[model samples]
Target: MFDYSEIRQVTSRDNPLVKQYIKLRDQKKYRIELGLFVLEGARLISDAISEGLRIEYAFVTEQAANKYPDTVAGLMKASIIGTYLIPSSLGDVLSATQGSQGLYCCAHTLDKISAADKMNTVGKYLVLDNLQDPGNIGTIIRAADAVGIDGIFLCGCCDIYNPKTVRSTMGSMFRVPLVDDMDYESVISLLHACGIMTFASVVDADARDIRRVHFSGGSAVVIGNEGNGLTERDASLCDQEITIKMKGNINSLNAASAASIILWEMTDEE
Candidate 1:
């Protein structure tokens, strides 16, 4: 096992690896080139390990090594390649977190889910149409994972690779299959052909109440933008439009919150 003590200490900001890390952290190109992304904190690291991500190197503070020895030990054993004990100051520079958690790692970015011959039949799936908030996307991902949704479609929205989305997911980004570059028409036709009932989630349309809808077959729910909701084009594609009956005075629900409610109702028991 590699000792936690001996790895090269990176103090200078000019260190090549540190420079690369900064680039990857700040820009998207480096992440794509290295096929890697940075993950911070103990919880996210643990989740990455659980997802079987290949962690090439880990940087932890000595305090973390002592305080979370078991976590450090797992990081040591599971990170067959190596581990490093970085200075707290150095780790602070390396960390993307608002508050450094004493642990950080470099792991390959989640592999893209290919579109060709994509599996059409699924127990449950979600389609995001022009949803702009990264946090909302991440929360939807976590909800999808919790409710046993097969995958997600990010249609005409923000990039899934955005760091905020990854962080918000709490590592569900690693588990859920997501496709971003999808066309609306193709998505509708494909799901329809596979016997999946596609439901568009919107407010006060001639839509059915979510409680009344049957989730008996392969199912996919479509959620729209936070500001504008679903486009008329995407909305027209759904076999049905569904809405959660909100008793409160609010006219509509936030896209992510609404999605979680519907997903729980549709897939939680199943």
Candidate 2:
């Protein structure tokens, strides 16, 4: 158990650690440079701690401490170095969004499954190609975790540690396995090498209806950007082009919505 005796009270916003938290909260580049990210809200912090994430530093507002004493105490015990009890006003500087929960923490980013050989041969996977929206990425990660996807390959997606993305995952950020740095070509080649059928999700009428295709073992669906859909080259490289059959005039689904559907279909056994 982490030592709780190290908790300190901070009255000034100029505190170096406070500034560090702000940087990690707002700047993705800085987060990547330091290999750390900031998580806001007691629930987010608690969830991370429960996942065995060691908190480098925890900042809790006095108001939050009174409101969530047990959670605050838990943070004290989970923090690896120090826990700062700060005023509500300072919490604003640490928060990325309005109505801040007044709970925050800095933790190193989780190691992802980046090595090619670490991936198995017969597991379900999701490949995101140039999907930039952070919220969509987060929602898809949550969906992937719920549907028991084997892993997620983020090929040119936004920073998975984007504050909005992190919060949007609702703790699934800690649960889902990820490959945040792979390129499209590498992803496709790896999947094919492992004998996984690559399915390209598209809006084309000529594509195979997803309902008719059997999601056999070792399936991976490539979800494209929200606006541009799949690139021509990407679609052609895949084993099959698949589409979710829509009714009436509905031509396309939202990225997150579409991914959820495709993931369910891939995991569903007929």
Estimate, for each residue in 107-166, the C-alpha lDDT of model 1 and write its tens digit.
777777775466647568888988889899999999888877888888887766666777
Q: Model 2, 29-98: lDDT tens per residue?
A: 8999999998888788889989988789888877888787877888888788778888888888778889
Query: Count of backbone clashes for each model?
Result: 0, 0
Q: Least lDDT summed over 10 consecutive residues: which range in candidate 2?
A: 1-10
Candidate of highest lDDT:
2
TM-score of each: 0.89, 0.95
Where in model 2 is the C-alpha error above 4 Å? 1-6
**Candidate 1 accuracy as TM-score:** 0.89
Clashing pairs in 2: none
